[model samples]
Target chain A: MIPTLQVFLIVSAALFSAGLLAALSRRHAIFILIGIEMMLAAANLNFIAFWRFNPQSQPPTGVMIAIFSIAIAAAEAAVGLALVIAEF
Target chain B: MSSAAFVLIAILTLAAALAAATLQKLMHATLSFAVALVGVAAFFFLLGAEFVGLVLVFVYIGAVAVLIVFTILLTRRDVGKDRGANWSGALLAVAVFGGLGWAVFKTQSVAIAAPHIRALTVKRIGEALMTSYVWPLQCVGLLLTAALIGALVLVMEEKR
Candidate 1:
């Protein structure tokens, strides 16, 4: 229970860094897409973690942003992969 | 240290994300991403956002993950052997990430002003979506619709 936010933040940073590396280093387009997903997940983690930690003062803006971001991410991935498929 | 469950989830999330990014096999990487997303969903639950967590499962695990794997299957030839990574990129990533980690660490002491969140139920979420967040919600729906149409168009090409 305690330090849950800390753990989540650390994990989110790790995910973001790994995703950035993968996106930069991968040759295949699909792997890059995977990297993008990891980054988005990291962002999502940050949103939820912050929302959890500051439950008494902040509105659920982080949660809403996270959900909206997830929606956008799903759509972006669908379109991006479809284009990649067509291009390849 | 807190309960074992929290530590377990943290480990699972990190391990899954690491595997997802580092695995050489494309299929394995995609699967690992799924695992990582699931772990994140669990984290959301622990954060008291049950609706968001389940939505993550549905959208990520069910839709997005499946879409990526299917795309991989469609373009099977492009997934060549892993080319490994460049040392420069790796070093740059480390330096950039180390700086970011330090920044967050330094800011950890600042107190954040947060409001109390009420229970987020389907009805409450729907009400908020339709009332205050209505425009954004509609925009998202429009975007998703367009993307779906575009996907169909992209995949429905004449056979060569």
Candidate 2:
């Protein structure tokens, strides 16, 4: 059986914390981008978890959001890496 | 959807994430970051979001990770060198995690298992984007184009 929503939330929280640690502790710009991407993935995990656990959901809202969110994150990664290269 | 599988994925994800955050070698840390993303995709699949899982693996691992590795190689720094973790930053991360964990435990959720519904197909998602979410779709495309051009401009060598 699927684990409770709380378990997913806790895992997502841990992922967020790790991402924060990476972003804050690292001096390199690329590390910061990696951290931000990790954090976004954690949030996406939460969206899917919530969508799956909710018994009353009708539309595939979370899936759609995750798709768009992935696109935005990809764009961000491109721009961010370019900035890192330009700055150095 | 077995709890055992979830536990395994959780362990893999957390371990990879910690390694990514704490590893000394920049290259190693970036690789660990890629591994962590894979774990996240696995979680998405476990939760029955197969399409999202595939996209996560495709975009994140295929495009983003390769870009990061190339950036590291192109920078020509002593990537082996390590400043290591900033203690203050680590402390802040710990504090935030503690608070979030407390909040998560406090909240109540009635559903313990995934609900039965029609399988989420890519066609349905396509229809939704074309109909109800067409505006946001167009806007995202516009934003992506802007970001692409802006990035190219930023990295362009200045004229003498």
Candidate 3:
């Protein structure tokens, strides 16, 4: 048996907290961006975990949502960093 | 629920987070973040979301991380070592985050249990995207296009 979904949630929480710490503690703007990415990734992990333990009738829908989210995140990061670059 | 894979993921997650937090060099921090992303992708795979896992790696590790590094390189004249964490800030973060974690765990204890995962195939996802989520899909496409246009304008403004 795999570790329960609860364990995954805990791990995600830990990741999020670490990212938060980085965001707060780091002075550099770039490190803050990395922290933001970490938080997003942590959320993505939760989505996948829930999808796995809680099987939907449709099955692939959950994973597809995550995939689409990843794509959107990529686009957002691109535009965000581009703006950061242009700004600084 | 105590599989070896879960243990591996837990270890990877914790280790990567530690690296990202403790590393002084900006480039090293970015690399640690990549490691964490890889660990996250692996977690997705274990959750039976192979498509999601692959996309996580490709979009996040391949595209987004690289773009961020490029931005750092281009924007900053020097990517130096970050001064390590401030003690007061770290303490405050830990306190707030610890409370949040406790709340999440406590709520989960009362919520409905999750069902076993069954369908995680690519075919099912494609069908759902085409059918139930058509509008959202279109919206995302439009958003991406707009973002790209905005990025171009911002960069051009810098050149001027």
Q: lDDT per model, in order?
A: 0.79, 0.88, 0.78
List CA RMSD, all candidates.
2.6, 1.6, 2.3
Q: For model 2, report DockQ.
A: 0.74
Q: What is the lDDT of residue B37 in candidate 1?
A: 88
DockQ of the candidate models in sequence? 0.57, 0.74, 0.61
10 residues in a row with least lDDT, candidate 3 chain B: B108-117
The CAPRI class of candidate 1 is medium
Model 1: CA > 4 A from native: A56-59, B1-3, B78-80, B110-117, B157-160
Q: What are the interface RMSDs of all the models?
A: 2.9, 1.6, 2.6
True C-alpha contacts between chains kept, each model in order:
0.61, 0.77, 0.69
Judging by TM-score against the true structure, name the best candidate.
Answer: 2
Q: Write the per-residue lDDT of candidate 3 for residues B20-41, one digit (tens) a residue.
A: 8768988788888899999998
Q: How high is the lDDT of residue B80 in model 1? A: 48
- TM-score of each candidate structure, all chains considered together: 0.89, 0.95, 0.90
Per-residue C-alpha lDDT of model 2 across residues B1-160, encoded as one tens digit per residue: 7989999999999999999999988788889998999999999988888889999999999999998888887777675456989999999999999999999887765336567767777787788889888998999999899999988898784221
lDDT of 3 by residue, A1-88 (tens): 5477677787888888788788888888778878888888888887777666764546455566676777677777877888788878
Candidate 2 per-residue lDDT, tens place, A1-88, comes to 5588888999999999999999999888888898899999999999988888877656778877888999999999999988877776
Residues A24-75, candidate 1: write the lDDT tens digits: 7787888889888889988998987787677562346777888899999999
